[model samples]
Target chain A: MNEIRIFSPATVANVSCGFDVMGFCLDSVGDEMVIRKVERKGIHITRIEGFDLPYEAEKNVSGVSALAMYDAIDVDFGFEIEIYKKIKPGSGIGSSAASAVGSVFGMNELLGRPFNKTQLTEFAIKGEALASKCEHADNLAPAMFGGFALVKSVSPLVILEIPSPEDLYATIIHPQIEIKTAESRALLPKEVALQDATTQWANFGSLIHGLHTGDFEVIKNALHDVIVEPHRSKLIPYFNEVTKAAINAGALGSGISGSGPSIFSLSKGIENAINVKDAIEKVYAKTGIDFDIHVSKINSKGIKIIN
Target chain B: MNEIRIFSPATVANVSCGFDVMGFCLDSVGDEMVIRKVERKGIHITRIEGFDLPYEAEKNVSGVSALAMYDAIDVDFGFEIEIYKKIKPGSGIGSSAASAVGSVFGMNELLGRPFNKTQLTEFAIKGEALASKCEHADNLAPAMFGGFALVKSVSPLVILEIPSPEDLYATIIHPQIEIKTAESRALLPKEVALQDATTQWANFGSLIHGLHTGDFEVIKNALHDVIVEPHRSKLIPYFNEVTKAAINAGALGSGISGSGPSIFSLSKGIENAINVKDAIEKVYAKTGIDFDIHVSKINSKGIKIIN
Candidate 1:
């Protein structure tokens, strides 16, 4: 086919106990993109709606990722792109990742799927680096391959797709505030105590086991962050209150979604996720901050073709 | 019912990428112990053989663990322990754990199993602390529950039992040298770079996934230790050469078994394990170090009842 339309998902990165390594996709929140093959020999952005982002092909994340994929292939025809951005930028929910994954995923489909998930992630992360100022695949992997993605390494780029429980759901709260990725990252210390690192890895290993075994109790116990959250959470208002509210409302666990300004909690079912969302909403309402909340099932499919 | 004989398996702990948290049991290397009940009201050590150890109930590891178990229960009779120890102390292959696990496992069986595995691990770690000078369950959990064990946490201890591949085998080479656990631990840096910690946890999470899916390639790639190996390997002479030899001989991965002196390598089958053992032995032979090599299958059953 010469044309393709796809739904590229929003994702939660820096999952508790799995900072810089783990992330999962969301089904209910995403961005829509359409790509069409043209006879010309260059990539072009035909339209963008709902968010003011750089429209220049070289400046946009979608364009950068598409260029990364496009350069690796021998395609005679060029591509035209249109994006309907719904996941806001700097909301800590992988807005840039959606754009980055969308372009590569759609281009691959249009080219009859020449690249695998790992290659797609490599190309997507190049675009992700433009936004985060650092290259990490935690968000890109899940948005590209779906379910739970564990980025085992970044240099060699190994992404392990872990199975999520069928009933698992996510509740996300995105406060409409911008926390620059570089500034948020600067809040972290360059070094961490060895003892704390051990605890983090222990919980990380246990969380992976819990997901495999479908044991909610293990998941609940394992969802703790001793490394990153203690520092970054201070940047987001009501962060502690929202997390406590989510847990009290029956979330398995809750933590800062990515850098800041967005928080996520995971639960067993849609009903419980809704309860967590409601509880978080009540906590955030008093802060006088404009925010958006979403309840999503774990998106096992990642980026998907759409009509 | 008054008397019980058991074989308590030795364990390899601090498996690469899972320091202080992961371990596995060995079928061919362990200690044999016999425990019997008497009309008295306290725990006692009746005989010692094969290895020299304290005979008192409180000072000996076997006795210490048994007393811990005995005091928590309303047992009507005192216990007598006869040890036919085969594992050497300071060998870094869970010699103390075998002794510690033996008394509790035999006593639990004799008392009709009043405590669960976690409780038993708790009691066993107390005995392990006598040897290691710290409380960590990497070895104890594997010796008690068998196969692979991940000590997910210490306080509110959580041990996750991971399934081993059917054909997995271990090759252990113990160079007859001494490295005290306390001294070995002191060589480590109290703080580690965040980048190194991230790399460690990534490999750790991937290793757990590899074990679950029985993927040898994933296991080979994931079996790495960036944090502890660089420092600890210095204590073990010809460490890098032995590890290289094992890998060259087709072992999946190799690292320091515990604190030091003993090096362990994992292979896919008994034949590969033997090949790895030969390779390791060849390297250590030139060093003029008196060493013992053991090839054993993965012990799925931790402590077995013996005649």
Candidate 2:
């Protein structure tokens, strides 16, 4: 009862049409953290694995989130968190989010669930802010709540979990290339055309409708990114050809995952999802670049207690 | 059936966060049109009532829509459309859309339903283009398909009908003032700040999620308009007071419908709808301005045959 371990799933943010607001979790790749009561009064990082992340409690995502949990609780409890990261850093698939969400989720469980999901999400976002320098819940919301989530606002912390069809499949490809989130975000335009904004909202609306109705064609049409993708896709290699190949191979929709270097496509069925993965790989095979492909369905279950 | 009669309902477009894409219909206030077969090989507007619209076939919305049906069918079918307008023109309640949707819907019914709802919507947008000088389906789509609708695109004509909770109520207030759609649209900035655009999409996404999930609090939070309402609401009399009054009186959400001169609020139940109407009326009573109020539920049945 004094020690617990949890796993937080990797997440894809933005989701093409909903920039800075929408995201969903992946079932497979993630980060694992083990929390145990320690003699010290403050949070401590005992060990880090899979990546050369900062071991300082104040500098790490999990440590910052643990600090937030301490600020929320009145008891003078202390813990040492050991993180095993499976998601690579700068992968644009919510690597930092997994650590942040895992810490808060694990700590809450270790303390016998003192806070609800919403409070845990708030703490996770505080941890995310330490990494991104801005507070956002697009990744943490889904990583905590699962399925598809829309973060309406960060102030009052309104996060809505949207229902997704059972057949929804996500095919993700992460190229072994690093694109810093700050550099990618800094490339965005300060202002966008009114017409493009209108189009983006329409797409976002249709995507929501399609998710509710389980209509694949509507999702296909709604998965276009008119604003962010046009600018951010430049950071990735063969972004256009890979997306086109996925679409040609029966993907319901395709787009860049999170920030860059990783691309994802959605399909209606497993066969189409595999076909899309192969089609994308066929294009990526030509570049001789190191890459990874993951075909997953919508992750309805987010973070889980492993031990 | 050589003769057909149909009524096209009034609609509230924009729907707060979704400008130019979202809309829903009203039940009681609308326009009626009667279509009958004729020996002449061309469409004609035989008689128009309640508005000083053009009698020429190419100039009238009904005539133009009937012409579009003729073009789509590729047959020399002659028809005469008589429009009885009950919805006031320039009231910002989709008056022109009523005529346009009524024409295409009645023509389709008289022609034995050759075109489906999507096709009929296409023809209706052509009719709307004659008046607004732009092809928009926000009003026409809901008037043709009923309930709430999201017009994804006008190019390939993607319109999706969204389901609504059965108890959802629409309370509308139309002030007898004229703010031309052209002038109102011209007031909008050609480019909007990226921050504002992101906020708008988040609201829009939440609104769609709320509508599908039937969560009133989500809808209440999502109904805020940051881009268009701030500028267009200035054109209407007592816009702020009316909206505040409606919300204060238990309405779920309130905002200016479409361009201006009319405001609408959504309530969860019939009693709340009535209370919202009364609260809005009490505010408008001080303005000494002529205005009409209509309380209705979501028009699940859109254009209907009268005979």
Candidate 3:
């Protein structure tokens, strides 16, 4: 039955120091999955277009999470699933989160919308868990609710809305490189000094205040992360020089986009955003790295289907 | 030269996880210091009413900070200083901060208000260093600016004003037994796990959201301190039972107020606040502890001269 067809958007997680609990929906950059009920009483999965993708059901992250949802809810139904992977697979954005959220969002519509955002978020979290062993909803909430969002607590996944500055623009530069999430995470320290942690909290507290008050300078200062960024930054070839140049070129702040390889710089306007993108691209050019630069507004709306 | 006389309030530093970077004005409970320009060559000191407090000029925390401004600016001026201690000594609620802020606030006024809140806070922090051996300004901002506040970054002392819930009521219970702030601080760990730090950031991030959005429940869940309160809670007698009782009796959240010996439970209204306060007081009574309970609204205005 096509009555259950639904679409979900893509999201970004760890919006600066909010590791597992903070994320937001961007109007641009996302994926869409459509689920349909069938009388076959079995799950069937097939890639709609891309030949660079997997074909196995059990191995496919989306199929696994969707199957898990059906099994958990004990829903006796078969489904046909199609994924429009608008967001590039390894963009350091929420690629799988978009899939998980899409399947759950579409499946719920197919299943009479039995769950609310929190409940759906719970199911989507399971989807994330199936992929990462840990359920990080920073990417999910923004995908689900559309606009800047946060998960207050991960245990219950208390997602809250974060204030977004209107004049802000983001420039994302993805230098084609392969650094698996596992390897990236492994490079991070398992423990940090208490003083550094306090600094993180202080920055985080101020970041929220800046967002709420629409003060960009506070946001700029609060974007400093002494815990993860410093250690993981070494992986990227010219992270220091590029970031420094970006800031010098009038970008408000810059950081490793998501889990790295890609870099993002936030700016106050279009000119500053373009300068940030150009600055980041210049570093990749010096390293003989091929990259794609996207200068866009903070996508307030997360995921939407083009078709 | 009778310049305008003004009194600055005492503040509570280290709101559990927000160490050295968070404080709020106590409109009612704080010390008062008056500054009036006099025909003299140097600053003079006077300790006014309130429990016959010590008036050690050379080593006085406020006196030292106020004196630093004169040395730095090289403006030799004469002024009469008076300290009317309102908040008790060794109380976790910024006893030292009151005098520091008072002196700085008064000195700024005496100096034609050349120093803004940040500068005054800096001077106040210098005063804090003389007493606590640490330079911090959390208490000074709230003492100077009033309402719920965030100190943000310490080096530059970036102060921010967080929106407090409209009906926020603070029920402070001070047990007669004294607990030194240094001892309470000493009980904390030097290092914290990555997972725990992530959780703390989630809580901290949520706290800002709670304060900004006025979500009492979010604030309640976000008020926990994994880094400090867990370790420090053991030192306070009946801390466990008091917190349990307060939460059970409709308190949004409860914790060791400031450095403790004094415990505070936050509630949305008078009835719930009183209920939580009485419940905790009842628990304290079981241990035969003599405690004074103060049930009042969060004083948005810190310290004001009555006469």
Please tell me which predicted candidate would have the highest DockQ against the true structure: 2
DockQ pick, better of 2 and 3: 2
In angstroms, the error of model 2 at B49 is: 2.0
State the lDDT at B273 in candidate 2. Answer: 97
Better of 2 and 3 by TM-score: 2
Provide the TM-score for each candidate, comma-separated: 0.99, 0.98, 0.94
Query: What would the per-residue lDDT of candidate 2 be over residues B143-245, giving only the tens digit for each residue?
Result: 9989999999999998888878899998999998889777898789889998999999999988988988888899889998898888888888788899899
Q: In angstroms, how far off is B285's CA in candidate 3?
A: 2.4
Best by TM-score: 1
> lDDT values of the candidates?
0.92, 0.89, 0.74
> Which parts of model 3 have CA positions greater than 4 angstroms off?
A1-10, A72-77, A110-112, B1-8, B51-54, B72-76
lDDT of 2 at B186: 78
What's the true lDDT of residue B13 in model 3?
Answer: 61
Please give, for every candidate in the order listed, the TM-score of chain B alone compared with the true chain B: 0.98, 0.98, 0.92
Choose 1 or 3, whichever is better by lDDT: 1
lDDT of 3 by residue, A1-307 (tens): 4634445654556666666666656554556566777776655665454425554656666777677777767656687787767666666777778777777677777777787777777777776766666877887788877767878766766888886888788777777777777888898788889988889888888777888888998889887778888887787778888888889989877777667676777789889888887777777788888777777777765554334
